[model samples]
Target: MTAESALTPTPAANAAGLPLALDAVGGDHGAVPNVDGAVQAARAGVRVMLVGDRVKLHAELSKYPGAAGLPLEVVDAPDVIGMDEHASDVRGRKDASINVAARLVKDGQAAALISMGHSGATMAASLLILGRLPGIDRPAILTHIPAKTGTVALLDAGANADVKATYLAQWARLASTYLKVVEARENPTVGLLSIGEEDHKGNAVTLEAHALLRQQAGINFYGNVEGGDLFKGTTDIVVTDGFTGNIVLKLAEGEARVLFGWIREALGSSARSKLGGLLVRGGLRTVAEKMDPGTYGASILLGVRGLSYIGHGSADARAVKNALLRAARAHQSRLIERLSTELSGPS
Candidate 1:
């Protein structure tokens, strides 16, 4: 479909449009959170299709106070791909919710798909079922990190561990399209992940990929940026291979948790510290809430032909609601089609 057609807003008469197919059987905590989140999304005027065992979903939905009247659908899948199931096994099993949800997207029965399942299995399902956008090698699980200035798109969060220069450039283009859609920033600045801003820096892949990204006329390449610059919001988009991107993501999560733990302990240790914390409790809580990654829903799987999101397994209703809104906005913005066109253009 054309970019304009892909993003045309749903008619006012049908505000919610098609229901989003959610792989309810996929997360580590089984189906409870998934079911609860789906109910929450539906209450917000977003219809949801819960894909899992029909009997189980019905049982859970019935337990919810007002679930019976909600705009929800339950798609039956006899078997669920266990959290520990291999990607191949999940793909081979037709009864898995991941495959079924993907099929819903492919069949035009759903606007998008959301899952807090195995990251590997989600990518595999998107690729094998929805297929990749033309000229896009692998689908990158790109996450939107909230920064002080705004939000930054970090790609290849955990998709392709090993990548080529071409794939890195594709990520830039994909992220650029996303920025245009979400931020409405014309010619959004793009930066490569590296140790320093110097021209000759980083390992073999980054150095070579830096040159390639610079050469790509489509992306507004902003040279090398350090890992510390991620939250600094130095650029609109940060491009890196999946290996480095995954490492940075994990390190950031760990550090954020550690810092919060330290702050909590320090404040509670002594009478003076306790009094000081009480004085600044409101400000500290506000800062911590804003800095929390959970404020931003799951990451977007960019470059795929269909809409799919991978959220954290620990995501609560608030995070899931954000993710659903993001998916809807992505459809409304036509970000995927724009990325496809940009990446398919001359490199």
Candidate 2:
């Protein structure tokens, strides 16, 4: 089929709904992991639409047994936006894999989108294609971050570099609703990221947001929380400007990697240490799994008209599979529609 027809609107899906659009190219490792995730999602009963190079994607899918005859379809989209390219650089490449994925959602042929490509390109394609839901000024890159206890849901992970107090209040509203409704966490606490727990200790933007979030109804707003509060699971939902949220996310990921590396080195440093490690292998593995980024899949780009997920460029097959499952769950929960409703309601 031609590129244009491959992307054309198709008949509406059954009541079960359209398949998820998995962008199968432009990842750091290539299309295999993306297709692998698609296969897993299909096996788990989530219909998938693989969007990428026809020949390469099909070749990868053929390598996996039982991939054929599953509720999965492929849309030939050969164009790709490299990780190094700027977001706007994708604007001209309408046939790019990510752009096709977004278009599938736009054309009602896909229920959601999952990709580990250039994040900026993901956001740009999503905005340019699906656009934002009504009443949402900007889309926040939100992720469900696993912690020692319960998970912490953070918003504006890296979407808007510049935002206002009002934007943060919106993030609180959407995040709290998601945690309560989707995650089954009743009355999820909303914490404003700041230097100190005191409300007055933040900068002008955060100070203003503190008041705004406090006034917002339907959310259990906590006072300002510091960086330490994030992993402590001190609050269920943490709201911050994109700049700070991005920093917190990257730093935490880096620290976790370093900390785990240190542990591995110390465990193998001596024979006695190795013996202890063997004894606690199961316990250590349990802890490691919880800390692993793949456990949570990718971050959800909330406030968009449709469900959109963005994973790390270097995500492996496991991460991609988890990301697909997460996106399917988001679609089943009607997260995008619920977020829109909440935003339209009272502050």
Candidate 3:
């Protein structure tokens, strides 16, 4: 595929006149959130192809008023890979909902795909169907982590549990391209996740990776950053092995939830505080918007051939809709093409 083919054509329609393909049967709530999400995106002027069972999809689509009037299409792919199913074991099930949507994107029948299914399955399907980018061996899971200033790119979120120092180096290069093409950030700074600010704090791998990043040339390496630096906006991109990255991702998510819960409890402790809470509701909402991970949508699987996004398995309608929008944006911005080209060239 050519560089331009990775992006979704935005004028009138795509070359195949297709929209995003959503695995409408993937979420935990069955087809409700998926259908609602598709309706929401369509109402927002994005064309969508909800991929799932024919009869069930139409039934869900009919629940929303004016849904039929929007640019919505349905393609049936009835099989579903359960959340507990191992990705490798289920790879041959080409008829699975996730696999079907991936096939659509791979065959040029759709611009991009969004799935709130077994995340590993989604990643596996993307690799199995769409294949990897020319120079990338393993695809990294990249997501927009809400930061104190703006949002920082967190990569290798949960794709490969173990990666080489060379992989981390390549991740920095890909992240730089991602920041430029999709995020519009020029010359984004990168930081390696380590125990301390010192260059020699991490293990042998990180120590080696730090040296590699410093000499990587194209990307802006800002040396080592501690865990506290993630939300501090210390750097534009944070790179780490999938094991560490996944732990950090979950820790941040849980921390945010607990923090909000505590605040809510403290606010309702008394009438005086309740009034105070009411007064600060607007301010709190602004804070919530900044902290909510749903605002960032699905983790973009970089190094994959076509654009594939994986949403939370328990995603609600809002989260699903945001994932769809994120996928569309990545496609329109040609994130995959840029990463492929960047990695294909010299460091």
Candidate 4:
């Protein structure tokens, strides 16, 4: 099929305002948080299709009064893919919750798929079933990092560990399109993550990618940005291979938790500190909320033919709710279609 035609959603999939398909049994604590999150999203006016063992899912739904009244439907998926299972296991378990959820999107029964399950399995199912967007060599995970100014878009968060310079350049274009269409950013700037801010600072891969990005049209290519620049909001988008990007993402998450814990402990150590803490409690809470990974929830699997979001395995109800809402918003915004046009257009 032509690249454009391949990227186009089936008519059923394109039907206005379809519900988001959620893997109800895929997470550290399966079913409970997923059901609660689905209920929360339904209350917020987003339709949800919960895919899991129907009996277990219904039992969980019973915990919330009037949950039956919400815009929620359960799709029976008898199998489950454990967090420890290899992603390739999806091939053997076609009835797995993640696979079933992905099928909903492929069949046009849902607009998107959201899973707080096995990350590898989620990515595998998305790529195998929905296929890649035209001109996309490999799909990358787009993650949002809270920055001093605003959120910074980081791609290849954990998709392809070893990548070529060309892949990095393509990700820059993808990240740019995503920020503009989904984030409403105008002419978003791109940054190549490297050892230093200089053009010749990085290793062979980054050095080559920097050259490609400088000449690439459409995106506002910012020069090299160091690791520290991520929090400084040095650029609207940061491009890196999955290995480095994944490390950056995990390190940021760990540091944020440790720092916040230290702050709370110090604030509660004495009456004098407690008094000061009380005074700044509201402000601290506002900052804490902004830093919460749950605030943005899942990472977007960009360059796929359809929308698929992979949430943290330990995601709580709040994270799940946010993920569902975000996926719905992206689909409503026609993100995939817009990305296809941008990728297929003049370079």
Highest-lDDT candidate: 4
Which 10-residue span in candidate 1 carries the lowest summed lDDT?
Answer: 2-11
Error of 4 at 245 (Å): 0.6
Query: What does the lDDT read for residue 315 in candidate 2?
Result: 89
Poorly placed runs, candidate 4 (over 4 Å): 1-16
The TM-score, computed over Cα atoms with residue i paired to residue i, of candidate 1 is 0.92
Superposed by TM-score, candidate 4 places the C-alpha of residue 131 at a distance from the truth, in angstroms, of 0.7
Alpha-carbon local distance difference test for all models: 0.80, 0.83, 0.83, 0.89
**1-347 per-residue lDDT for model 1 (tens digits):** 42223322343422457777888877777678888877876766667799989999899888899887777889997787677778787657888888999999999898888988887788888889999988788889887665767667898898989999889988898888778876578999898999889979999898899888888877798899888788999998899999989988888788878898999899999999999989999998877766566566678898889899998877776666667666766766666677777766786
Per-residue alpha-carbon lDDT of candidate 4 for residues 204-290, written as tens digits (9 for 90 to 100):
999999999998877999899999999999999999999999999999999988998999999999999999999999999988877
- TM value for model 3: 0.93
Question: After superposition, which runs of candidate 3 have C-alpha atoms over 4 Å from their true positions?
Answer: 1-17
Tens digits of per-residue lDDT, candidate 2, 265-341, equal 99999999999989998998877777777777688888788988899999888788778777776676777778878
| Candidate 3 per-residue C-alpha lDDT over 1-347 given as tens digits, one digit per residue, 9 for 90 to 100 | 31122222353533234599999998678789988877877766678898888899999988888877888989998788888888875567878888889999999888888988888889889988899877677889997787776778988898989899988988888889988987678899999999999988999889999999999968999999999899998999999999999999999889988999999999999999999999999999988776776666577888788888888888888777777766776777777777776776875
In terms of TM-score, the best-performing candidate is 4
